[model samples]
Target: MNHIPSLNDIKEVHERIKPFIHHTPVLSSASINELAGCEIYFKCENFQKIGAFKARGGMNAVLSLSKEEQEKGITTHSSGNHAQAIALAAKTVGTKAYIVMPSNAPIIKKNGVKALNGEIIECEPTLEARESTVQQVIDRTGATFIHPFNNYDVIAGQATATLELIEEVPNLQVVMAPVGGGGLLSGTALATHYLLPEAEIISGEPEGAADAILSFKSGKIEKAPYIKTIADGLMTNLGDKTLEIIRMYVKDIILVSDEEIIAAMRLIWERLKIVIEPSCAVPFAALLKQKERFAGKKVGIILTGGNVDLGKLPF
Candidate 1:
């Protein structure tokens, strides 16, 4: 039976990765609420290991493999976060990690992978280059490919973050996350389904890179040919598995312009006194832009990652 992940599946992931991951704290800013006219709770995955929530999915993907598969090691292509994730996951499991990164990937992220001892393979930034390069790595090493957002184990792992979020802050009326490849958002939809059944699952997508919103409207999965945004982490197109779950469970997808996203990022930095990447700010941008719609509601926003290059602050 092919379907969305069950509650128990996500629960198991939560328990399995408990020792390796953080039970990240939920923080809120009254200034944000005054500005948005809602009670907003931020599940700050910025504080998670590897500086992002990708750790949960990546760790789960690696650990879920049979001992035989684990011995073969793991490989993945990521611009940043997932690369470090798999590298760390492999390290924890005592296996090799072959990380494929784009030539133009941020220095901060590339250095993080190196610090974790993952072998780095640089390639052209195009999707084709990434896929082909990863395939070559897999063929040469026989390593299992852990897709950034498409694998079942990874999706279940991503769900554990939201499961923790809802459990910590019960009675959320709306839950939102930035939608890129849909791993986090899809997993988030599953969390809302089981934990906060009355909560509406929403997505925040960049206006310049709104593939998820387009797919939701067209009733099918679609690709974005020229996605350009400050939110680099949210630029990837949605995968089929993620799209299926998103279409079935997500209630709405909101589009926020680059200007709005940058503004929201600044607000969070100044108000919360925390560092978050531009991609992490997409959901808050959605909430800020649509203040009236979410007024008087309890909203949970997943700050997906905090892997930003300090040298390139958009403000």
Candidate 2:
């Protein structure tokens, strides 16, 4: 479990989480294909439990815990989706969840965590503050801290998304996702490496909070030059574990702007008739940005989540 997940590891994670999560549908739009000039299959994690792919990793991480660890309960720091995932997972396992969330996290996400009965501790909107807050919570409650993206168990769990993707739509020529702290991207890269060895794994990153792309090139975990993006879920920098896997397996990380993200978000709403947050639209935006590169190829895009603040609509 400490090493990078093998094909068997991902399959086991899928089976472990199957009862707790949705086998979210793989959707396609003919018009989207015409626009991107590629045959695109969208893994709609928006319809997933907790309305994001974070559920997969959260459930797997919590479920993998020993009975002693489960009794101590689990804690994590997340902007929104991961918080909800941890809360729901903890609830399912009959344990408490301590969620350290940023003060600036969208109200919708905060409410989702509350609805799941997570104890919320608000902190300043920075990684430093988040770590400090989570540490304090662990100190006070003796809870086991679950890192949002940096842990192997979480990465293995995230890999199940791509595992299911290739199982349903085999032999995709290109697979894409949005890079945040690189959990989903690294997981996607690893799963594609195991199952579809010939498929090129690409990821979209926010141009504003653009650290993963820099890390991908530099071969180390690097910080963003500045942090500003509509993709709140993607603002964090990459972790060391995630960086190592990403550098080894991922092919490219494409950068997309807020404008392009919004445009892509709107396109999915109009064409696919599905609600997706700005971050979920990133990989599709990346595909649109470089249509010629993926032209006429079979592409699978991981629509990571749908947790947008309805009141603060970017469109």
Candidate 3:
């Protein structure tokens, strides 16, 4: 628990946060399977609390805090889903949440945090600004910082999604997720390593915000060459903790174009009748991009979130 999370750490976190989080379902589409040339199982975290899998990690992180820490409240920097997640989690634990968000974050996500009673402090849309803003909030309010994807507790909580998936649909040949700061991908890798050791753990990353694939290849955290992705939730680069776990366990990180991501997103909406954000579509897009490699395989893909801005949907 102190270092990288073990399988027991993830299981324990799941039990601790279960009351506050939904056991999101595993869904599949025969049409999608036919198209992808693989039997695909989707972990539908779009239906999760706060409408994203971030609910699991955010709840676990807040609930894991000590009484003294809880009294001081919690704070974090996030683009959207994680911000709402921390807000909802703080509310559940009867404490205040101070969220530091970029000025350009979606209005829907901003409203979501407000609905949960989280105090929002907007800053310039950059990582340095976000960190400095969070530090300022911490200094003024004495709130503990809960990183969205970097901390071990958050990673353990994220791992529970994959654990649940494998539990529901065992014997998957490959398991995949989209990489942003690598929280969910690292967690997915860990869960697959522990439970389904034989299963290959892969990830899809936006070619626009394409740092993870480079980091995976270089064995160190790297920034994207340029950032201009419709997948707003995936613009951030990998953190040290997440990068370490991802490098240790993940098999591959595939790159997908915005066009491909949109196509995949539309297919999910049409075939599965589920709404997924662009980042959520990246993994499926990767699968479709390289269908021949995984032909006739059983694959499990974690649909990370469904928090897209309705008016700004690409397709």
Write one digit per residue (lDDT tens) for candidate 3, span 1-315.
Answer: 469999889999999999888899899988888888889999999999998999988998989989999989999998778898999999998999999999998787788999999999999999899999999999998999998899898899999999999999979999999999888988899999999999999899889999998988898888899999888879888999999999999988889999999999999999999988888999999999999989999999999888777887785
Whose lDDT is greatest here? 2
- TM-score of every prediction relative to native: 0.97, 0.97, 0.97
Give RMSD (Å) of candidate 1 vs. truth: 1.4
Tens-place lDDT per residue, model 2, 63-169, is: 99999999998999887788999999999999999999889887777888889988889999988999999999888888999988998889999999999899999
Candidate 1 versus the native: TM-score? 0.97
Regions of candidate 3 where Cα sits further than 4 Å from its true position: none
lDDT of each: 0.91, 0.92, 0.91
Backbone clashes, candidate 1:
0
Between candidates 2 and 3, name the one with more favorable lDDT: 2
Q: By lDDT, is 1 or 2 better?
A: 2
In candidate 2, what residue range of length 10 has the lowest lDDT sum? Answer: 306-315
RMSD of each: 1.4, 1.2, 1.1
Worst lDDT run of 10 residues, candidate 1, spans 1-10
